[model samples]
Target: MKLNYKEDWPLYLIVLGVITMIAKEAVEVVLTPSKKMTSETNKNEWHQPSLYLDNELKGADREMVLYGENLIANTSYYFGPHGTIQPITNGMNCQNCHLQAGARAWGNNYDAVFATYPKLRDRSGKLETIASRVNDCFERSLNGKAIDTSSKEMQAIVAYITWLGHTVKKGDKPPGSGITQLPYLNRAADPGKGAVVYAEKCQTCHGNHGEGVAEGSGYGYTYPPLWGDHSYNTGAGLFRISRFAGYIKDNMPFNQASHQSPALTDEEAWDVAAFVNSQPRPVKDISHDWPDISKKPVDHPFGPYADGFSEQEHKYGPFQPIADARKVK
Candidate 1:
C-alpha cells in the first residue's frame, strides 16, 4: 500500500471537523464576554430620564409635578388602603404597570399623551381628554374608582404627563411613546408551555399564585400580581394576549429583560402571556368596548366578532387570517 491519501480521506475529514469544533468553542468563549462587556459599556448612551428636579424647577408647580411622579411611582403610598389621599387603588403602583414611572422607552411611556389626547378612541368611541385617559386607567388597570377630574392628585398626574411630552410639538407623534408590538404568531400561544416559563422566570417575582409580592408593611407591591383580585381587571389592556405578549417581550423578569435583549424567545413570550391571561383576575364591565366590532383588534378575546372565528380563536390565535379577511373586506 503506497500511502493512499485518497483512501484515508475519512480520517482527514474527522480531524478537520474536530479542529473546527474546537476553534468554534474557543471563539465563543473569548468573544461572548467581550461582546457583553461592550454592550454594558454602551448602556448609558441611550436617552437620559429627562427629569426636572426641584432645584431646576422650583415653586408649587414643580412640587405638583414631583407629586405626580410620586403618585405614578408609588400609587399605593398615597392611594392604597392605608393611603391618606382617600385610598382609591388596589395597592399596586402605577410604575408596576407603566414601567419606570412611564420614563423607560417602549415601557408604555407617556411621551405621546400631551399631543394625542382629546382624540377619538375606538374603545370609548369618543374624543377622550387626558383626564378621561387617567380615569380609564383607574377604572380598569388599577381596578379602582375614577378620580375626580378637578382633584389635586388627578391634576398632578396630568401635569406630569404634560411635562413628559414638553419637548414634542403639539401635533407630532413621538417615537417610542408606547409599548412596542411583537410580530403576530402563526399559531396559538401555548399556556401549558407558558406555565413552565412562568415557573422558571416569572413566579419568583409575581409569586407562585400570581398574587404579587408586597413590599414593607405598606399595601404597595414590589412586583405587581399578574392575576387575582388586586391585579388589572379582565377588561384591562393586559388581559389581551396581544398586548401582554408585547409587554413581556419588551420588559419582564424585572431589570434583567428589555426589548434589546429579550430574555424570552417570541414563543416563550406568547406562551407566558397565554398563561397569565388564562388565570383569574377581577372583572370589569366591557359591554360598551369595541362599539364598532369591525374596528376591534384581531386579539380582542371577546366576541361576537365581525368575522366567523370562535371566541377561543380571538383569545389565542393565528390572527393573520382574521386580519387578512378584514383587509380583503
Candidate 2:
C-alpha cells in the first residue's frame, strides 16, 4: 500500500517539493562520482546529477518541454527530410549525435550548452544564440534548411536544451560535457588501413557500404550512414577527421565502446575516421565559415587557411605542427 500523505499537510508539502526538484533536473539516477556534477574538477567530487522528469510537470510549460524532448529524441519522425512536421534532415535522428537525448555523459551531451551558449563561436566569429547553433546542425549535420527562430518547433527545442542544462551553473564546465579531445596522430591517418578496421568492426551495423540499416519501412536509420548522399554534408563536424575520430573513439560499435574504453585504438579510430570520410557524401559550400582563417582548427579539411598547409595536410594528421604555428603567431 502506498503511504497516504493525504491528511499530513507537512509531508505532502515535502513530497511535492521533492517532485518539483526532480522534474527540473532530469539526470540523477545514473550520476556517477567521476562526473563533474557541480563544476568541480576533482576526479571524484560529490555532487548530484539530474535528468528532468516529465510526468511531474504540469500544464503548458510541461507540454512544451516534453514536446521539445520528443523532438530531440525522435527527430526523424518530426523534422526529418521526410518527417511529418517538416522535412529538413537527411532522415537522421538528433539522438544519433546527441546520445540518450543529450543526457548521457561524454556523449555530446548538452550539459554545457545552456551554461556556455549565447557566446562567440570562432567558426562564425560571431556571438551565436542557441537557435543559431540549432540551425547550424540543420544546415550542416542534417543537410537541410534552417527552421525559423520564431517557429514553435525551434522554441520547443530551445526549451528542452534549456531544461536539460538548467541545473548547470552558467559558465561552469560540467565534467564530461562534450566529446573528449583525442590525441592527434603523429603520422597522417590512412584510409587504406582504416578499411580493414571498418570491415572487421563496423560492417555489421552500418552495412557493407555504410548505407546504414533501416528502422522500418520508413527512411529512419537504425545505425546512421557513415557517408553517403543521405549522411551529414561535408560541412558537418563529422566530416573532419579530428572531430569524427574523437567521436568514434568515445562511442561506436553500438554497446561495445565508450569514452573510456573505446573498442578501437587511437590510430584505429583516426584511420577508420579517414576511411569513412573518404567516401562520397553530399557537399555544402562553407566558404564563408571561419571568417578569420587564423582561428580555424587544423583539420577543417578546407582551404584558404591562414597557414599555407596543403588541403591534404589539413585533412590528414601531423596537425600539431599547424596547431603549433598558429599558436606562435
Candidate 3:
C-alpha cells in the first residue's frame, strides 16, 4: 500500500500546477478586457491640427512684429461697430486700448497669449477659454463690455491672436523680456522713394502734413495724425517708420472697403511712413511701460509686445540711427 509514494507525489504536484495556472488565467480574464477598452478609448479621442503646422497657412512663420505691424496697418477691426462693444476711454477702439494691435508702449501683447489659456485665472475664479480671455480684454483692458462669445468681433480678434500664437514656437515660452526691439528699415525700404509714395498714396486721409482728419462722419480722424500734439506721442508708436509702414500695408482707412480699395506694397507703406515721420511734430515725453529709453527696442512700439532684436540693439539704432545714417554716407 505504501509502495510507489514518489509516483503519487508527481501526480499531486501536476494538479497543484494546473490550479495555479487556472487562477492566473481567471485574474487576467477579470482585468484584461477593461484595460484593452481603455486603450481603445484613448485612441478614439479627437485632436485638432495646429494652424502653425500647416505649411500653406499664409504668414505661418511671419514674425510677431510683422503680424502686429499688419494688424496695425489693417486696424479697421478695432474701430468699427461690434469691435470694442463699448467706449471706455475717449471713444477709443481696441486699437486705442491696445495701441496698434496691442503694440503700444504699455499695452499687452496679444501674441502667444493663447498658449496660456484654459488656465486657472484668479479673477474669473475658474478655468477660462481663449475666447474668455479676449472677453476679459474687452471688459478690463478696453474698459468695455463683453462681446458675445461667438460673435464675429470675438472671432476676428481670435483670428488675429491665433496668427500671433503661430509666430511663436508652440509650448515654448515667448522670447524677450518685453517689446524692447526697435523698428528698422527692412532691406526693401527706400525713404526717399517712400516720400513720393506718401504724397500720392497717403495725403488724402492723413493730409499733406500728416494732420489727422476731423472726427464724427469721418469716423474720428479719417487719418490719425502721424505726428502732432494730439497724435500718439513720440513714444506712443507712430514715431517708428517701419511700424507705421507695416500698419498702413494691412489696415489703413476706417473702412474695410478702403483698406482693400487700394492695396499698398510693403515698400510703399515703408516709404509713406518714413515720409510722414520725417515731417515736423511736437515731441512730448509720453508715459511708457519701459521708462528707460535706453532699454527699449526701436522696432517694438509696444514695450514688451515686439520681437526680432535686443534691448541694446533697439536703442543703438532705429531711433538713434540718425547719427549712424550720417556715418554711412
Candidate 4:
C-alpha cells in the first residue's frame, strides 16, 4: 500500500532473478547441440557391413564384390551418376579413376570435399554451379556426357558422398588417412621403376608422359593432365606427396575389376606420386578456404542446406561439438 515503496525492492529483485533464470534455460535449449546421434550411428553401421562383407568374400565372389563395391563407390565418376557427363576413358567406375576414393599419392579423394563444392567453377570462362561441377567431372573425368541435375541416380550419388563427407569436420584438410609410407627422397623411389608401372598401367589413357589424351576436337582433356602445366596447379593438393600416394593406393588406372589394376605397392604409389610431382606443372595460386581448416561434415559444406551450425558458425565458431564418438553404439 502507501506504507513504503522502498520496502518492495526485495520482492522486485526476486522476480527479476526468476525471469533471468527462465531466459537462460530457454536459450540453452534453443542452442543446445543439434543432436545428430542417429545420423552418425547410421554411418558407422553402414561401413561395418561393407567391411565385414569384404572380409568374407572369396574367389570369384570376392572379385565380384570388389567390382560391385568399386562401382558403387565410384558411380559418380564413371556412370555419370551425380550429374556427371563423361564415361569413356576406362569404361570403368569412378573408383577406377580415383582409386579407392582417390587414395593414390597424386590421385583425387572425396574426403574434405565439402569445403570445395558449391564453388564458382570456371569452365572455359563460364561460371558453373554445383550441379555443373558434378557434370564437369562426368564430361572431363569420365569422358561421358553430363546427367540432368534432377536425376535420381545423381541424387543417390550425392547422398552417398554427402554421407562420407560428414565423417570429418568441415574446412579441414584430410590427414592422408589412406596413404602409404614411402622412402626418403635421397632413397627416393626410382622413377625408372615408376615409369615401367606407368607404361603398363597408366599409358593407355593418361599417355606416355602423363599428358592425358585429347577427347573430341577441343573437348576437355581425355585423360586429366597428371603433372604437366595443365594438370592440377602446384598448390592444388596433388602437389602433396602424401595426398597423392593415398589417392593412387585407393583409386587409379582404368580397370578396377581386379585390385591388380594399379598393381602398385604403397611404396610404389609413393614413388609414382614422387615422380609425378617432380614433373613440371604450372605454379599458380590455388585459392581455398584457409586458417579454419576443420574437417567438413556431409550434406552441404555451405548454404541453407547445411546442418547444426549457422553460416557464421560454419565459417567461424565454437565449431560443432565433435559427436561423442564414445556415445556411438
How do the residues 1-329 of candidate 3 rate in per-residue lDDT, one tens digit apiece? 57476769887788899999999999999999988976675454222234456555564334443443443333334433333333321122445434445532213345445566667654335677877876654443233456676765456666666655554554443432113222444353455786787777667877877676655643334456665543544443445555555556545433331222436665566666666665655444334334444344354333442344444334222444533543454
Which scores higher on TM-score, 1 or 2?
Answer: 1
- Tens digits of per-residue lDDT, candidate 1, 72-134, equal 998888878788786877888888888888888768878778877879999889889998998
For residues 51-151, could you state the per-residue lDDT of candidate 2 as single tens digits? 35445557887778778888888888988867998888898887788887777777877878999999999988999999999999988888988989999
CA shift of 206, model 2, Å: 0.6
Overall local distance difference test of candidate 3: 0.50
Best by lDDT: 1
Minimal lDDT window, size 10, model 3: 173-182
Better structure of 1 and 3 per lDDT: 1
After TM-score superposition, the amount by which residue 105's alpha carbon in candidate 3 deviates from its true location, in angstroms, is 20
What is the clash count of model 1?
0
Query: Using alpha carbons, what is the TM-score of model 3?
Result: 0.38
Pairs of colliding residues, candidate 2: 25-51, 25-52, 26-50, 26-51, 26-52, 27-50, 27-51, 28-50
Q: Which regions of candidate 3 deviate over 4 angstroms?
A: 1-191, 217-219, 253-262, 286-295, 298-329
Segments in model 2 whose C-alpha atoms lie over 4 Å from true places: 1-57, 217-219
- Please give the clash total of every predicted structure, in order: 0, 8, 17, 39
Better of 2 and 3 by lDDT: 2
TM-score, every prediction = 0.84, 0.83, 0.38, 0.38
